[model samples]
Target: MERKCNNLPFLLLMQTSKVIHNQIKEEMAKNKLGITEFSV
Candidate 1:
């Protein structure tokens, strides 16, 4: 339990980073779709 507690912050940071990255990827994909539609 002590070891897990020590690593809790790092684990939370990684999880938050993954969430932000995924959101950014989704937004980029949406913008790309708009660009493609405009070109067509």
Candidate 2:
């Protein structure tokens, strides 16, 4: 039980990190799309 409790925060942090990375990727993709559209 104690081990599980200790790991909870680590798991949460990993999930949050993944979410942030995904958001950055999405934003970058959107920027690229905008640039492509502008060029065309």
Q: lDDT (CA) for every model shown? A: 0.76, 0.76
Q: Which residue pairs collide, candidate 2?
A: none
Model 1 misplaced regions, further than 4 Å: 1-6, 33-40
- Tens-place lDDT per residue, model 1, 1-40, is 3545468888999999999978867876877755456457
Report how far residue 14 has shifted in candidate 2, in Å: 0.1
Task: Give model 1's clash tally.
Answer: 0
Per-residue lDDT tens digits for candidate 2, residues 1-40, read: 3544468888999999999978867876878765456457
Judged by lDDT against the true structure, how good is candidate 2? 0.76
Off by over 4 Å in 2: 1-6, 33-40
Q: Looking at model 2, report the run of 10 residues with the lowest lDDT sum.
A: 31-40
Deviation (Å) of 28 in candidate 2: 0.2
- RMSD of candidate 2 to true structure, Å: 7.2
User: Quick one: how many clashes does candidate 2 have?
Assistant: 0
